[model samples]
Target: MKTNRHSLMAKGIMVLLSLLILIFIITFAWFTPPEERNDAHGVSMKTKAGSDFEYAIGFKTSQTFGEYLVTDFTNSEDSEWDIEDLHVPGKMKDDQITPVSYNLLYDYQPIDITGDGYTLIRPAMDYGNWKINTGSFDYSIAEANTQYISFDLILRSKAATTLSLGPNSYAIGASEVEGTTAKPDGSKLTGADVERKSDYGNFSRDAIVGAVRVAFLGFDDTLTAESYSTGTQDDKLNHTPSLLWVPRPDLYLNNNGNDLSTSGWSLNTGVTSGTTFNLQSQAMNDAAYSTYRHQYYNVFEMTNPNDTVEVATDNSDYVHVSAKDTEGNEYHLNDSVELISLDKPMTVQENNEDVTYYYGKVRVRIWVEGTDSESRRALSKGKFKFSFDLTTNG
Candidate 1:
């Protein structure tokens, strides 16, 4: 009877061991495999399965100006001119001067006056046998004859070679010359007594004479004097002037034997199994993209391509990357990032057989941070290329 009790006890122990094993197997099979992670230089990539197959994606960038064209203006005349004949004063026609057009929506003052002053003045009287003392004469008497002309320029959007001066934009000087010439009685003829005679007539004697100077103002805060002969005028105003409105960066994704559509850089992948994608960017020209402090953010969204059903819509799904300067220091998304790299590798898994296909979009946003006054005025404008490598492992 004792031998029979021992056998029954052994059978019960065996049954308990079998139930434990079955439970363990069922629990392991119910849950999916844990994701694998890899990191390099502070950048991390996660995937459900190891990447075995890889393919490179090539991206080419082409820059195109907005509806308006950025142009440079040049003055055909010299900086100074000699007005020999008063009848025909040295005239700088509107055609000779280039005008700026307003295509952007920002308020722009093309020309700024920096300084105004007379450099030299010489007065003479055209009276016969009327000897008068030069130093004794009142110079203020000729002030009425001296008139300054100014142009009221306007900015308009039209296809033309040159700019046109607005209506009633020009101010004409005094037509009649007014000044005192020596009289036979050794007296002075003043003011209205002067006639509208010849250029140097007795009525116009002692008329103000001097050289008037004008120049293009510097756009920068220094307010430097820019001249035409030295080519500083064109350098300051025409070449690569600060843009008032800069457009956003253009991004594109090219896959195997597929190109981007006119609609944008949106990509639609037909892969059912999980996939991995690699990202890289191309540097743009200095003229096109100028930024003192640059920053970037990578946004993503997952949805059903056919049904427009949303899948991953939270901020957790998005990843942030940064650009490095000449030094090896890393910049945050909120800081300037001149040279950027992939923040992290992305991994997508199949939730259901019916939802085999994953439709998603990757968007990149770039901006400039203003740390100082100079950097605040700095703008970012350009077209850059980004390459991708998509690998699929089922």
Candidate 2:
């Protein structure tokens, strides 16, 4: 009787195990179903010279049942397409369940530009003998099974000024090279082009790697103190120190060529129209009052009872006068004056009011120097409006 009880107990245990396994299988089928997958697509485009190009991607899914989750597309580190798997669950004959995966191949329209989505991908340069390439960021998407889904992409070039580096002409593959150098065998050298693909969006794969080297660096005029010579002066004065001087006139004569003893002018001949004078200086650190001479013409303007004076000098707006050594090499003077007028003055029988005038900016060009006077010495083009301060010689 005990043996009979053992056999019956063993049969009951087997039945229980089979029931459990059947239940597990049914539960899994109800919760998670297989999804239809999409086929991979390829990318190719033809662009115009100096122009931007675009392409698009399109996808479709099978009819799905229950709730469907359509996620963003993701990209591989090197490819340019979005891919995802579909899943479905529940009864298929009733509305509770639906067909999962469908056809693998579909139409993918070219975006107006490059890359994925409606975003633009710009070329780095013009379309010439060179090539252009750029990379996009990685992205991803998730979708539910047993549902029909679609992906649409619009590509175009970025706005102007967006393409300023790297290749700007041809589309290159992994085997192609970029850069301005050549291989030892005299062939051309190039750089790489890689972008990530995902549903989340896009990002740059790496920094741009190559560009041609330009020859001339920008010139800083303020930092340059230079001068060229006439046959009278040396070819040009570089950062020379001996040219520093502050110029001022020491003598003045009247229209008759008679020396005027006073430092200013007192006019009677129609308000002495020539009493006003202009002072100008050269750019140089070592300029002195002794190194230069002055020549000027004085004129007067009369308005009824008041006389206005104006002075004219040799220094014009465009002329730059510099100093030179015995050899004629032009040098920068800390200061040099183009004498307009001197201490001598014209006798005026009437209107003697003094008025000061001002003109033009003071520009200087200097060099790096260590000597006391030579240090920071600049040769400059200087102009001044005469301050006609007339203290009535009571």
Estimate the TM-score of every prediction.
0.14, 0.13
Tens digits of lDDT, candidate 1, 300-361? 12122221111121121111122222232211122211111111223323364331211111
Clash pairs of candidate 1?
294-336, 294-337, 323-339
lDDT of 2 by residue, 77-117 (tens): 22222233222223144465553432211211111111111
Candidate 1 off by > 4 Å? 1-218, 222-232, 237-246, 249-251, 256-277, 280-394
lDDT of each: 0.16, 0.17
Candidate 1 Cα deviation (angstroms), residue 88: 20
lDDT of candidate 1 vs native? Answer: 0.16
**The candidate that achieves the highest lDDT relative to the unseen native structure:** 2
Q: How far is candidate 2 from the true structure (C-alpha RMSD, Å)?
A: 42.9
